[model samples]
Target chain A: MTAVSATPTATPQPRNAVIRSARDSLVVAKRNLIRMMRIPEVVIFGLVQPIMFVVLFSYVFGGSMKVGGTTDPGVYREFLMAGIFAQTVTFATAGAGAGIADDMHKGLVDRFRSLPMARGAVLTGRTLADLVQTTLTVIVLAIVALIVGWRVHEGIPKALGGFALLLLLGYAFSWIGALIGLTVRTPEAATSGGLIWLFPLTFISNAFVDSSQMTPWLRHLADWNPFSATVQACRQLFGNPGVSQSPAWPMQHPVWASLIWSIVIIVVFRTLAVRKYRHATS
Target chain B: MTGAIYAEGLVKTFGDVRALDGVDLDVPEGTVLGLLGPNGAGKTTAVRVLTTLLRPDSGKAVVAGVDVLRHPNEVRRLIGLSGQFAAVDEYLTGRENLQMVGQLYQMSGRDAKVRAGELLDQFNLADAADRPAKTYSGGMRRRLDLAAALVVRPPVMFMDEPTTGLDPRNRLGLWDVIQDLVAGGTTLLLTTQYLEEADRLAHDICVIDHGKVIARGTSDQLKARTGGERVEVVVHERERLTEATEVLRGFGKGETKVEDHMRQITVPVTGGAKLLAEVIRELDSRGIEIDDIGLRRPTLDDVFISLTGHVAELKEDAV
Candidate 1:
């Protein structure tokens, strides 16, 4: 072993702080992803809920829901898959928040803060991990949707675009989760706080029901909701049956709306979350 | 030589309570400065400031010659910190935890892997290297945490109550590791409520109370400040306490104190074991029945009591 002299001299560390920060974030992300792989139960449990939603909503309410001027159960099932995919990605926010909150509660964030790495890397890395998890969940949910007779009439490129939008939306929401995780004191509180608002946000949107069937004010609210925009965009991209006439500009241009909404969310929440992280660990 | 850790006039307040009030510290390179304080005495707060984890309201700190507030990132590269709580990731294996930290410190992948294996072996965690830290005992977790701190072998280290929750055997083991680190010339500032721990580890002990340094010296120096060796005798009968006090005063160097209720008399003395033997022979001839008698040096406990008028408020967190 080489004897290390404890001289208080500045060792020549890698000077590119920016590059080091990016590398550090990737390292943290890798750690989180490895943990998920080791604990297959997390992935399994994450898969179970989306699978249940696909099966239950397909069989229970499939026949009664009207879409594209018809009550055809098959058409509704096809329409519902897009909403389920969007909801699944959004709901991953809870796990992201809980994971981050648990890290904070355990003093892991303190450890990261004391290190000479980028300050925002810990959070960005965590959100990146959630993005990977969301991507995997979306893949498994798509197969379940296929098993339930849901098919995309759009070209393969458009179908890929829809999945891309779902992942992007999930990534954006995970930042909000990161913010809540930093704000809350416990993992349990973060889980509740992360998922509580999500209920109304997803339920009141055009994901589960037709915004055209609701009252004028309700339709307007649902049409403009960011959640609805993603759902509508996915529906159009997948060539599903739910795209009906609506005066809401977002609904008419769901693809552009979904991109803009996700970009805006990523910008706002990432800034706030990183700021909160600095204050919290400092 | 430039001090490895130096801080001046650090002041921090949480609302009305000043956790650290004008605290100054200087720990020259290649030495250990034990920050001895009771609960809530600002030892941890001072450490936080020096480690760049907290920004003091008004202070100047230069750690490893980097201005803490101005170049905290540069300072961070030169120091390692093991906090009061073992901050190892419970979900990651011991080796994985160290490797992750090594990578964060910008060591290359192969170096991180090799270093992790080396640390795990050195910390006696080789057997559990592949097991998640959550499955390890408290001592094992602490060892892993300390190992993480040493991954880069930085010039300075700040360990806040590092052995607070360790068994005696584990604490001794950790002490040996620390001794090895210091022998390699690392400067350390360690904080602890256990005076014994401070005595065993610190080159210089700074005793703080109520957010201020009340005394600072070498262990022996501080002990001497409390007083020299003393003779303590508990008489077999309460009525003989006064007579015992007079007998003890003759042998002792200073005023003798008698506690009538406990039948005990105590006094400072210069002589070591020879004086103790003479006192025993004299008392035996005087026919004073002795229940217990011994020569006692001033321990850090005694020093703390004399200086602060209260025992160090030790919590039973140490296992």
Candidate 2:
């Protein structure tokens, strides 16, 4: 048999590394976005939970719960929207983790690892795709919030800023989810592992109830939670009531605290998640 | 010159389990090297290391003239890998999957689309190209996976048990595709437990067991190493087993083996069919009626059993 010599074109020309990484990441992201579009039920289910929280909290305990000092239902509805929006974005961490874990289980990650693409592209692309889904979910939830007597007292620009911060926080938390996904054995484990900490993280923060009502130490812990910082930031940006009067630094400067916390989480967790991804065996 | 794909003294351990214990391999350009082994024999581990999916504990590997450990990304550009699992995205259409793979390989969008169409047609997946891969059968999915691996037509390819779970017809179909790839000058490293697959496709076979290479040669060489042709006879009467053995031993080159319950006698021999006819005549003249008699060459199964003291498949945890 005649030997086929390696052709000159067979060897890829050297390109800018950063540009290739970004391009590869976008390609992966496009694939995932297509998958999400095909599986509409996942997006629908993602939307249903946040919508339910909005409706249930607005009608059930709006008047009974006290925010600031009053028990007014209208006052509480405005206060509850920010918390629900933050919760909606943060809760998407489970889906991100489960999605990655499923990819690993099905060997798609192995397929990607064998390719010449950037090492972090798979994760960055996945998180970016998930961020899009979370954005859609937040949009629908905002409509639900509007129908339930929840209004953004601030101008449209500030409200958009609030939504931006919520997404940033969501994107940051996805790295944590990505790390959990890589660490766990199965998607089911990833789902559970992703949520087990989120419950405390969101609940202990100022997302739902007023932290001032709690005792001193628990209040302190709640005030310092990263989840609370974003929630507090959203409230201030949206010009919603229930702003914290706590002496804690983050409660006073919620927007800066939120930006710092999200950036820091992205740096630390993205580093860990990308490192874990490179050495992942299965 | 060294082979296009070469490795020396590769060692990888997963905790206490030594998945690969100093393995070596070399596959020249445009040739197929079959890494034949039972389950958990480190075939997957070796493929993973060569494909840059896993790092070996200690080893030297070069693919397409690039150092695997030091320049894995460069090696990745020159190789395609289809793993044990069909790693296509189930939610994506067949065309979408191929296009996605092409884009990942850095093909332009229009180029990826054109390549996807061509591959879908070549793999006989054109009809199902627009359908989600989840709707396809196992064989279709496997074909699509193979097509995905060929998105860029790299010079080197690694298929870990490419036909393990495929049905017979699909297995033949895949064998045809693989042969076409090799004929077009793609260097291939295929791993499988089926000796017949290795015999039909591999130019050279490496028999690995317990994370070590026990034998390496062409199909005929391994079979010849096991043993030559044997004359097996099953006598009609249980009482005549002794007579049959005595008759067979007269022409036998080795000790005659007798299975009393089956009334069968087997003896190794060097002569071809001529000796078999003479043995038959001798048995007939002695009034030793034979129920069955045939001269059979040792199959690769026999080679495996002889070399590893077990069959070519074992139920164990995968490496």
Candidate 2 lDDT over residue span A25-78, tens digit each: 899889889999998998998898888888888889889989989999888888
Instruction: Supply DockQ values for each candidate.
Output: 0.47, 0.53
- Residue A282, model 1: Cα distance from true site in angstroms: 8.3
**TM-score for chain B of each model, two decimals:** 0.95, 0.96
TM-score attained by chain A of model 2: 0.96
Superposed by TM-score, candidate 2 places the C-alpha of residue B17 at a distance from the truth, in angstroms, of: 1.4
Which candidate leads in lDDT?
2
Give, for candidate 1 chain B, the lowest lDDT window spanning 10 residues.
B310-319
Q: What's the lDDT for all of these models?
A: 0.87, 0.89
Given candidate 1, what's the lDDT at residue B122?
92
Tell me the tens digit of each residue's lDDT in model 1 across B70-113: 98887777888998889988889998999999988878878889
* CAPRI docking class of candidate 2: medium
Q: Supply the TM-score for candidate 1.
A: 0.95
C-alpha DockQ for predicted model 1: 0.47
